[model samples]
Target: MSETIRLPHKPDAPLSYQFVPGQGPLSTTHLIVYLNGLIAPQSGWRATIDHLRRRWDEGGSRSANHPALLTYDRYGQGGSARDPADDQHGGSHDIREVVADLHVLAQEIRRTKMIKDADASNEDDGAAAADQVPKPKLIFVANSIGCVIGRFYAQTYPGSTAALLFLDSNIANSDQVSLFPDPDAPGFDPHVLLPPDSTVADLRRTRAGYAAHFHPSAPNPEHLDRRNIISLLPLSDGPPLRGAEPDEGTGPRITVVGHDWATFAEEGLRGSMNVPEGLTNRYVNPPWAAYNEGLARLTSADRARGPVIATGCGHFIQKDDPALVAELTDDLLRNIEADSAA
Candidate 1:
């Protein structure tokens, strides 16, 4: 079911959230939290969530083993309140603020679940009953810029996250080539061609543009150095990237899903920009593909899965192939279950 509720901490901004409870014992059911891309509402994930929920409910008696789904809109998007104060520069927020909001939301969910589990445990007496209280087993499904927030959250609260799925997500430092195109490349002259004075409003005009500019090649002109760019890469040097210290099994299982097609040319600012064919081929594609591969190796262990190419889709892979997303999510859940059983 869905509800529009205000967080006690951020009482002015109401968040639209949906919670689909899994069948059977609450203690064992995993919670899959869906984080939307830049400027996307929670409703964007409707098809995928509906498909997965239906599959879970219809899986016969084993339906009870399925994970619960939680999807929510961040502040200033969808049903949530928009803070004029927060809206400045190009966008409404920076990555850190969005991650903070997500942290609060996750904590609230855990708090509520703990209370419910406590109530459930009251019916029985024993060490086993005490164990009935649920420990958070959160699976994060992050798309685009949402991946940045997810990574930060997992790093900050390593114990809470069990798995992370990056769906057509961005990689830090990937924009270098696109932002600072090589001067030596054919038909490339940054000085000759006027860079469009694009704003967040301009990019939001189309989905492709939104995806392309979500993490602009250079958000600010002053800080384009390699060190600054590397520092800006999401989860590049965090506990999330390094995995939990002391080599405990608490690190999240991560997967990076990337679209095979060169979709930025379709509908966004990039399409409208009429960028030189040579520039797009030389500067854009290589770094993007390479960074995605780097994302696959972020974790120290073999826990990383795919820079998996989505054959038929573009940047919005979940929308293009919801079934594939569902399959991947289910597979991850099964893996988590197997590990727990072992």
Candidate 2:
């Protein structure tokens, strides 16, 4: 069954979420909270949640248990809270708020009572059914900037999460080559990465260029930056990129990797749009250093184990290859189950 509800947050700051409860193994539920990339709320992948819910059912066949999952639109991106008025440059510059909202939302869901079986007179069976209801553990799945939010959440609320599945996501502190910082300067470039500080006419022109080069239909072109650069690409035209596959054997905490860089030409296109030339050199030369440090800190012990390159797909791996996303989701749940058993 599916239902939409608003989370009790700031009166103006409402969150939108879709709930899909899994059948079969009542005791084992997979609670997946996805932090979508930069795509608009009404886009293809947003609609693809229906398919993901169905895939959860398909994956249940192999499971030693059952699962339930939920997906929510983050504030500013979907039907959730609007961007804060103070942050005109970017309402959500501080991602910790997003993490806090997620935590609160999870607590709300856990507190709600599951519907009683129609036949309440089942006696002992009802007791078993009540006991079987899984105490949901959150599995945060995010891409691009969403990964940054997820990273902070894991670090802040270490024990609350069951596992994390970063799909083509930016690892916290990996030495991966990134267009985020300048190679020569080795730091973030405000002008190149963020919109250049210029006149309205010039900003419009830059925004147009971003729309043309980035995603043809960007809601707010001025919002483009190193953080969300990957989320804007359209998925309709890209070649099929192999995605992260499911593994029944592994535990829930996992990092499934994929890239939308396709070939050097595509990389150049992406480079032209957001990354500074210096950062590009750093990205290509060392290939890992520029992006690995934060990723390393976010992951520790058994939780930190992936850089599984998904070739052919660009930054929007979920849209580029939904199959991979579905596979990774399944694998993550399994891995979490395995970890609990250990």
Query: Which candidate comes out best when scored by lDDT?
Result: 1
CA RMSD for every model? 6.7, 9.8
Give the C-alpha miss distance for residue 163 in model 2, angstroms. 1.0
Those runs of model 2 whose alpha carbons end farther than 4 Å from true positions after fitting are 1-4, 24-30, 40-64, 83-93, 113-135, 171-252, 260-304
* lDDT of each candidate versus the true structure: 0.62, 0.50
Instruction: Return the TM-score for candidate 1, rounded to 2 decimals.
Output: 0.75
Worst 10 residues of 2 by lDDT: 236-245
Candidate 1: list runs displaced more than 4 Å.
Answer: 25-29, 60-62, 83-92, 117-132, 174-247, 262-271, 274-278
Alpha-carbon shift of residue 121 in model 1 (angstroms): 9.0
Task: Give the candidate number with the greatest TM-score.
Answer: 1
Question: 58-123, model 1: which lDDT tens digit per residue?
Answer: 773336676667899777667767643364533434555666677777667655654454465555
Cα error, residue 254 of model 1, in Å, equals: 1.1
Question: Mind giving the per-residue lDDT tens digits that candidate 2 earns over 1-342?
Answer: 234446665556566666555443333344666776666442435534555656655655434354555677766656655645326554333345666777877766654533332124346555435455445566766776566666556555645556666755543333233223332455634555443333334334434444454332334322323344234221211211111113222223546464633332256445644433233333332343224323433434365555555556666766667777776666765665565555
Q: What TM-score would candidate 2 get against the native?
A: 0.63
